[model samples]
Target: MFSKVLVANRGEIACRVIRTLHRMGITAVAIYSEADAGAKHVALADEALCVGPAAANKSYLNIEAVIEAASSTGAEAIHPGYGFLSENVEFARACTAAGITFIGPAEAALEIMGDKIRSKNHVAQAGVPLVEGISEPGLSDEQLISAGEKMTFPVLIKPSAGGGGKGMHVVERPEDLGETLATARRVAKASFGDDTLFIEQLIRSPRHIEVQVLADAQGNVIHLGERECSLQRRHQKVIEEAPSALLDEATRARIGQAACDTARSVDYLGAGTVEFLVSDEEPEKFYFMEMNTRLQVEHPVTEEVTGIDLVEQQIRIAAGQPLSLRQEDITLTGHSVEARIYAEDAEARFMPSAGTIIGLQEPTGEGIRVDSGMLPGLVIGTDYDPMLAKVIATGADRDQALSRLHQALGGTIIHGLTTNTAYLQQLVADEDVRRGQMDTTMIERKLPDLQFPTPQQHHAVAAGLLAAQLKGLHPETAGNQEEGPTGWQPDGWRHSGAQNPVFAVSWQPPGTTAEPQEFDVIVDGSSRLIPVGEGRYLLRSSATATEVHLTAGEGSRQTGTEIWISSGDFTGALSVLDQEAATHRQLAEIEAELTEALPEVTAPMPGTVVAVGVESGHEVNAGDVLVVIEAMKMEHRLAAPTAGTARINVALGDQVSLGQVLAAVEAEQAENTESKD
Candidate 1:
């Protein structure tokens, strides 16, 4: 075991590694960028070092800085926790040169698997069933088109380097090949600094299943069971589970052996994941996608189901130890599911939402584990991925696990920014996902229904509201209002007497729209009307300056003076006002637009247009991506009206303002556009 180890990463994964290191009695060292100086990972580590600027190239990705940090700290090993330099071959080689162990596959294997085209070829030669496609060298568009004729339609064009759905594209037909290839090439060059590409048959209705494997330098390798990662958006996994519902015992064994074989073939060391694309057809067929040469982001679910800590195994293997548990020793336990809570808006095309986390209330109980990156008052800037945490739950079976997950999500509260918590909760209870009838395309296919309101939603909302109100009244509720809001001020109402109040407030239950909901509450023995909007209410009582939190006709529960607030049950907060003179100047310009007339079209947010799908005088249907804007490292498609003739005022490279008229339609059709908004 390493006496001192350097975690060459930041955020949640870094914090996760530090916890494990602490448990194992190892001193954990952390490296941080300028922007991450106050990050949670830095505070959690035993020792921290400031490496470079906020930019990744200057900090997290800087090999020299990382090596220097380890050397200065006298660390024995460096754990590259996913992303950043985790899969970088040169970084691993540098660590080796520094006489420091890299807790992953060797530099040589990293080199081989780092390149997708080469890795796919090596695995194919190892007799691993690979996705059918073209791997010919230096294939041009003409040659690719010719090759496509032999295979099938809906081919995937992918970069030969790196993964994570970056530099990947799918063309539905031959006519879309040119644009798809060009786009893939551009993204590939940008993401991997390599423009090399390959073609593969796009398997429809595919389920992403990955096998976790551990190997030692002594030529011994063992396979952990599989994890189902079918719930994804833009190739990024949103939810994952262990012991896939689709894989039968025999198929699971076969895939496990194949995964182990591939690991041994590469002389793989430490922890790695072998990913596969399993078809949803009868007698599902599995094909290899690629091998992730480092620990995976969704590895916790696998650990929960198998009762194995993969990080511990990785450490043991890195220390030149053999496998502690053979294949038989590993027993698959009850079902486990993990939901990745991200700072994003599901209703808004899943765009990343950046703001200060005013409040955070993580779920706690048996069979639940939360690996988080952010805490209260943490600003979720646009500088990195928007993932906030991974919440995992285990149960006796799938239904039990799913039910626990629902409770966990409901209990998990994140305020101050929009998150996918509600979206994930809806997904877990989804009929298709519940029945285990899931595929890669299932999310996209059922997205509309999942996002929209259901018949039972109102009941759930009412119950949640009542529960929140009742919880607020508890003297020691799960959520603490004493935890001050991040940047907002909470009125000192408790100190103030219940007299000369400006607002009268009370709780209300489910009632008719015209009539008030039933709430038997009295402050100073006076009846008050509790305003209920939709299923919840925000109450301000005249007896006190601070807003009283009441649910289901409960007593007043105080809240902290902060812009951000999150309690497991009662999740609410106030927004901080920047009252400085400089702040007023910043809001001056925006105030003019607010008072002026509305424009013909508007730019949703600051972004670069990846495509101008509509041209001047072009007819477009509703929900058509008039322009695709890339913001916060994610794409946001600006759609058209139900019916409109687009008269584009902005060109492809032009930058448009928020609420600026990017296009206009005829007067009669313009009303339709306005109505949609």
Candidate 2:
């Protein structure tokens, strides 16, 4: 085994690799950008090095800087963990030249399979089943149109140089082909620096299946069953599982052998995944999609079911070891499912959310595992992927695994930032998902019907009572005799009345536009507000009594006292208004003025404006695209809410903050009157 290995990545995958290296008795070295100075991966590594700035292009993708870091830290091998430079052939060759082993396939294999067009051709020649499409390179717009016509309607135009759903478009009509192709080419050039694209037949309702293959230097290759990755959004996988519920024993063997054949055709080495698009209607028929020439993000599901440490195998193979186990020796033990927990809002088209994690509680028990790089104080930024962690559950059967996954997600708490935790819970319990009847389009189809649990009245009342008690304990206003256990006044009664002090409070549920619920809570005595711990309280009322987990954060100047409350499965933020503070009245006046202002298009999140589709005096209709903002490597198009004349404020390439007005739209009465005259 190698003495030291450098992880050439960041976030959860880097931490995962470091953990396995430590188990193998190898010191792990970590590389980080400026944004990840205090990241979990950096702290977990035996040695750390700063590569470059926060941008991936300047840091993680800088091949020379990574190589220098590895060499300077005396790392014997470099493990490119699934992103950035992981699939770059040049990085592999550079590591080889510098006498450091690359823990992946050979550079030759990467070159052959890295290009979609080239890989399709190679696999087709080797008799692997392929989807009908045009793989010829350097096709012009006219040529692409002609090819699309030949393939019939509903064809997919994809950039041949990159993956992750970037620069990919689907056109269902011939009339829209030209514009779609132009957009695809432009995005492809910008994203991958290659305008080369190919047309493929769009398989309706296909199931994504991939076989994990490991090859040693001695030419021994074996497959580790398969994983179902059909649950996706915008071509990126959301949930994945091992020992696919769809595949039978016979079909599993066939697909496994086909994947191995594809790998052997190029003398592949280390860890690689062979992806395929299996028709949902015809499970026996499968078409090769592409081969990822490095470790996969969903490899843990396979690891859990097969009881094999894939990272350990990769290192062993990189050290010129032969295959430790043959194909017959490998076995799939149970069902395992993994849910990718991202810092994103599922209700808002999965828009990426960035903020500091105020409090975190991970689930732990039998059949549950969490692989994460996040800590309580970590800041999720927009410079990298929004995935915070992955929660995986294993069981003897699929039903049990699904149940455990649902429970695990409920027990997991990620506070202060918006996340997909509630959405994940709904997905697991979805009727079709629970029955193992799902396809690539199921999530998008069912997204509109999925509902998040609403916060109960008792929960809100608890928050209100807690907030009122906390407010009275303020040393600045209350008698400074040192607050009581419940953070109430020393006398435990307001001087205003002996009956008790009743205050109106409001609570806004997470991820909703509904009006904030209002209720009145009376703090009569210590029995109603009991302090359990430093940041926990029990609120008792006539209707109900509940335990509330409260965490006090820095007070927002606009919202006053901000407290995060978690009761049962519902979590929300409560802003307390004493109705007595002078500041509250001032805030009310400011809010009233803002609410009466002219209608304007504002940025929903912090991002950079990539495109502005309107200008001053330009007339736009409702639902027309007004501006495109890029955040966390994804593009979101903001549309005009109503028909009007647009007065643009933000230009292309300008940074915008949440709720910052980008444009104002007024009724186009002037234009209409002029036209009539």
Candidate 3:
């Protein structure tokens, strides 16, 4: 085994790799950009180095810097975790040239499969079932159009490079083809630096299934079953599970063999995934999508179900050893499901949320696994992916696993930053998801009803109110309440007895533009309070206090109330903003102002503009890649649309402000464009 390994990546994946290395008694070296200096992965590594500035172009993507860091640290191998240099063929070759092992597939394999068109062709030649499309290279736009005509309307324009939905566009008709092509080309050039693209027939409502395979240098290979990754948003997976519920034993075996065939055809090494598009409309029909020649982000579900440490296996194989376990040794013990918890607001368009995490509660039980990068004090920054953690649950069967997942989500609590926690809870219990009838279009189909949180919102409001009340009674405020300028507190002197002080406070629930809920709180100056809102407030003083005295307000309801507290240590109540509002108060007010002021342009996520497609005064349509933001060695283009607008913003080479206005697009009408990246 290697004594030390350099992890050439950042965020949760880096932290995840280092954890496995530590368990295997190997020193882990972490590389970070300026923005990642204080990141979770950096603090977790045994050795750390700053490669360059915040921008990934000058840091994470800097091949020379990474190599030097590895050499200086005397690392015997470099583990390019997922994104960044994970799939970069040149980086793999560089490591080999430097006599350092790369813990992934060989550079030759990457060179062939990294290009989408070539990879598809290779798989097709191996007799794998491929979807109807052109996998050949060197096709002109006119030729592409001809191929599209053959495929008919609703064709998929995919970049013949990288994955993760980047540079992929879906055109429903001919009139949208040109713009989609231009956008795809620009995105392809930015993301992969290869403007090459291919056309495919769109598989409506397809379940994105993938087979996990591992191979050693000696050509010994085995398949570890399949993972269903149909629950997605913005082309990125949100939820994943192992032993796809939709596939039968025969179909599963066939898919597994096809995956092995594809791996052997490419001389694949280490752990990789062969993705397939399984149609929801047809149970037995599955088509080859592409092969990811590195560890997948949703690998935990596979690990949980198979009892395998994929990272440890990667290292063992890279050391020129065979896979530790044979196909027969692999067994699917139970059902497992994982949800990718992101720091984004699910109700408010899933906007990436950045803020300090005031409190955190991770679920722990018989079958729960939480792979996280966040703690109580960690601050989520916009310079990286908005993902906070991957919450996994396992059980003896599918229904049990789903039940456990729902419980885990409920037990898990996060404060400070907005999250998709409420949405996740709903998704697990959702009829389609629970029935295992999930597909990529599942979320979209249930979007209208799933767009808001009702019960969770009620609980959140109750928690917020409780938190506000708790803050009001804090020692600091309790000691100096009468001296405040607002004169909001009652005038009082020293009280000798245990007195319950009542105060009236009002708050508007989230998403409600008008009318704030008014409540009266009676504090006994102890640890708890009785809150009365639109319902009667009850106080429990004994174990059998069901019929305790109830104080009712006008229009009070018979339903009892639940509360939430903001403090991480506190249980049963939500955390409400404790600090009194200054001239401006309430989260809604702050959000409203931010929306009115901030521009619509997609901001950079710790990346550089590799290419600028437009200039001042250029009229651009929606979904146009105005500027490409490259980060962690990967490039992402910021596009326009959802409305069309003329450029009235700054020029290229300008160090743009965070959330600055790049251009203005006055929406001709409100419309939703599904994300391509």
Candidate 4:
């Protein structure tokens, strides 16, 4: 075991590695950028170092800076927790040359498996079954189209140099192939700095099953069963489970052996994952996808089922330790499921939502485990991945595991920022998901039907009443108070006895387009509304009396009052809008509407403009790509809204703000001229 190890990553994965290192009695060192200086991982490390600025290229991806930090801190090994430099072969080689262990596979294995095209070729040569498609790299757009024509329609364009579903596109129609390929290439270049791509046959109703393999330098390799990562959105895995319900005992053994053989062929060391695309129609047939050369994001599920700590194994293997157990020694136990909780709006097409996490309540129980790196005051910016945490649940069987996962999601609370918690709950409860009948396209197919829980009338009333009560207690407050009528007393009462002290407020739930529900809270001093201990409240209505757990705190005037209300399984935040604040917000919305009525392409999020496809006076059709903005390590293309001539405003490499105009489009008009003689 290493005496000291440095984690060359950030966020939850870094924190996870640090915890394992502490368990091994090793000093844990953390490297951070300016944005993550106050992150939870930094606070948990034994020693911390600031590598560079907030941009990942300057910090986490800076191989020299990371090596220097490890050297300065006396770290004997460096753990590149998945993503960033984890798959960078040069970084791994640098660590080895620097006399420090990389805590992962050998650089040779990384180089072979990092490129999807090359990895497929190697795996095929090793007698592993591969997906039927073109594995050749550097095919031009026309060549790619030609290859796809031979493979038939509905082909997938995938970046050969990177993983994590960053630069992948599915083209169902023949005519859309050209545009999709161009966009995929651009995203691949921006993300991996290599636009090398390959065309693959899009399997219909396929289950994504990956086998976790662990190896040591002594040439001993074993498999840790399999995980089902079929539930996905935008080609990104959303939910994952271990001991796939789809595979029978015979099939499981065959696939597990194949994964082990794949690893052995490369003399793979440390932890790696071999992915496969299993056809739902033909469960016996599985095709090799690619191998993740490092630890995976959904590795917790495999850990729960196999009773193995993969990180500990990686460190021991990197230290030249032999395998403690053989393939026969490993046994699969209970079923487990993991849900990735991200700071994104599922309803808004999973757009990343970044802001301070005002409040958090993680689920706790015997079968539940939460690996998180977020605190109450953590500021989630657009500079990194939006994943907040991962919640994993285990049970005796698949049904029990599914039930526990649903319960855990309901109990998890993330206040202030929009999250996919509600969407996750809906997904796990779906009939197909409950029956273990899901595929890679399930989430995208069912996204339109996933509904957020609607706020009940009583909940809205409770929030309004709570807001009004707090305002009365803290009268003369300027920042969050709503402007009341003239001469109204600070005690929440009017001088005129004839008028009832009726307060009108509106409550808006998170990530919904529905109009805010209005409530009239009549407080004549006769009604009793008292706050109990620990965010609980007792309210007396004209019809009945009820006790509600509610917490109210001041927020910016623009955000209204942040109120957390718990009503059974539905616990969430509500923005209570008083009359004055509501009117001001309405006016702001009107202004935004007026501005949007113009034909202009605006930045949806704050990011750098990577490319501008159209120039001034360039004619464009609807859905033509105009500008590409990169935010949170993802590229978003701004498309033309309608047929028009363009007027470009922003240039390449320009940093843009949210809603900043990047270009304007004028409606194309018919050219008129005098009749020629």
* Highest-scoring model, lDDT: 4
In the predicted model 1, the residue pairs found to clash are: 358-564, 469-551, 485-562, 488-563, 490-561, 501-542, 502-542, 503-541, 503-542
Q: Given candidate 1, what's the lDDT at residue 340?
A: 94
Model 1 lDDT, residue 39, Cα: 90
How many residue-pair clashes does candidate 2 contain?
Answer: 0
Please report the candidate that would top TM-score against the real structure: 2
Model 2 segments more than 4 A misplaced: 186-195, 472-504, 507-514, 525-547, 581-591, 594-596, 670-677
- Per-candidate clashes come to 9, 0, 14, 0
Give the Cα error of residue 482 in candidate 3, in Å. Answer: 6.5
User: What are the TM-scores, per candidate, against the unseen true structure?
Assistant: 0.76, 0.91, 0.79, 0.90
Per-residue lDDT over 1-677 for candidate 4, one digit per residue giving the tens place of the 0 to 100 score: 78999999999999999999999999999999999989999999999999999988899999999999999989999999998999999998899889998988887889889999999999888788887788787789999887788877688889998788777889899889988888888888877778999988888789999999999998899999999999988788999999999999999999999999999888899999999999998888899999999999999999998899999999999999998989898898999999999988776677777777766778899799999998878989888888989999999998999899999998787766778888898988899998989999988888777776756767766776777667663212322333476436443434443233344555555444468766665544444556675556676666777676676656655567878776555666677766566667778888988774548888766788988998878999989989998887678788998888888899999999877999888887778887989
Compose the digit string of candidate 1's lDDT tens values, residues 1-677: 78999999988899998998999999999999888888999999999999999767788888999999999999999999988889988898899899999998987788778777788888888877788889876788778877888878888888887566665777888888986786777666545667788999887788999999988878888888999999887678888999899999899998999899988887899999999998877535788898999988899988998888888888888988888788888888899999999877676567666666655668899899999998767767655667889999999999999999999998787766668887888899888889999888778777776543221222222233333333232212322245344322222233422221111112221111233122222122122224443222333334532222222221222311122223232333331211232244346747876784422556654445566787878877667667765545555556675566777777765645444566655433333444553
In order, what is each prediction's RMSD in angstroms?
A: 9.2, 3.8, 8.8, 4.2
Candidates in order have lDDT scores of 0.72, 0.83, 0.72, 0.84
Candidate 3 residue 606 Cα shift, in angstroms, is 9.7
Question: How do the residues 436-503 of candidate 2 rate in per-residue lDDT, one tens digit apiece?
Answer: 89998788888888776656656555655666556554212333333434434432445442334444
Q: Tell me how far the alpha carbon of residue 287 in candidate 2 is from the true structure, in angstroms, after superposition.
A: 1.0
The positional error of residue 498 in candidate 4, measured at the CA in angstroms, is 8.9
lDDT value, candidate 4, whole model: 0.84
- CA lDDT of 481 in candidate 3? 59
What value of lDDT does candidate 3 attain over all alpha carbons?
Answer: 0.72
Off by over 4 Å in 4: 474-487, 491-495, 498-504, 507-517, 524-559, 562-573, 582-601, 617-624, 640-647, 664-677
lDDT of 4 at 377: 83
